[model samples]
Target: MPPKGKQATKGQKQIQEENQSTLKFYMYIIFGINAAYLVLQYIFFYDSFTALYIILFLWAVGVNFGSYKFMSSMASKGIDLNMEAGMAEHAKDVILVTCIVQSISLISNYFWLLWLLVPGRAFYLLWVNILAPWIFAEAPEVDEKKQKKMERKMRRH
Candidate 1:
């Protein structure tokens, strides 16, 4: 027979795995939507060849570097590094933020002052480079036991 605590641990592990799978599914869905948007960008803004690639490259670099910094800081703080989650979250944020800033500026429709929009992309890139990793890099870890305990606690409420 398993130890009393061990049984709870096993149960907890199963629940944790289920939760992770569900979360991953959602993350993939979001990623797919973002990817589709990227393709749509090409179709709609066919004239913006250089801008699209530049934006993508900037986003990727921002995410990677941001994640690296986050992981490093976590290590320094004695935190477990969930680099995959960090990267995924950072990628999503960079894309989301970039699109929002770009779209909003465009919708303002001030063609006479088109140059004002040029800095929007640059601003996002700079902001992410400086802040993204620091913002999303070091999240709390969810071990099976902690996850189950949280679930049980949450269900109580």
Candidate 2:
């Protein structure tokens, strides 16, 4: 059998790879939806420059910048984007901004039917923003003292 240290390293690498693949899959879906929304906006609403269009465009730009900031903050913190907790937190922050902008854009454009598009995207965000990250979070390493304290607390409850 391999040394314990080697085995642990191997397991960590496998977890990293799995996390990376999952992140890539979700990113593709998110970007794809964004692209589709942009194209639809252009096709259906492109016309003489209007204040509403300008506002929507500005909001889109803000959302893009916000996403960049989110990624940069994670990098600055030395947080791996593939790590579940960090990824989920970032996703939640970005998704809230995205949802707000999308709602405003839909209302301004009077695309009532476009509201139908929201639930699926919201569901996707909810899953990645909460469920996936929680599931993938590493179990906290507990010292003997902490374990004893936790056991005592459990018994008291």
Candidate 3:
């Protein structure tokens, strides 16, 4: 049931359910692939690159998690850090670093599965760093600088 006056149609409800199901399906697939890869890596390449791969993977996870939390906190405080293409550059740098780790992991075929974490991370950034903040944050306070910019634009038109 919707709120007292808000009407949510059946189609909208269905779509939401479908999107959630799809997300779960994708998560299952990712988990399945990584789980299989881990088993194989343990069996065959246990001595090959396990130490370095684990270290690099842990490092990547730590960096991504830390940055996401920091950015999310800033966003929740209505401190929009997304000026210009700074966030885009940050995302690209993250992917680049992940790719570097992925490349090193490519020495073993089983480890190539870890490459999926790269795009997974990009999606994480889009959701956590970008979307969640804007969707759930307080409206930013417009100072004189922004007011003047808006006024100038209005005058131009």
Residues 42-128 of candidate 1: C-alpha lDDT, one tens digit per residue: 686558646645565355445434644554454455433333454445443444454444344333423214433435755786678
TM-score of 1: 0.32
Best by TM-score: 2
Which tens-of-lDDT digit does each residue in 95-144 have in candidate 2?
54564556456446654335445466668879998989999999989899
lDDT of 3: 0.56
Taking the candidates one at a time, how many backbone clashes does each contain? 0, 0, 0
User: How high a TM-score does candidate 2 get?
Assistant: 0.41
- In model 1, which residue pairs have backbone atoms overlapping below 3 Å? none
Better of 1 and 2 by lDDT: 2
Candidate 3 off by > 4 Å: 1-10, 59-157
> Which pairs, if any, clash in model 3?
none
C-alpha lDDT score of every prediction, in listed order: 0.51, 0.60, 0.56
Per-prediction TM-score: 0.32, 0.41, 0.35
Q: Which stretches of candidate 1 lie over 4 Å from their true place?
A: 1-11, 56-157
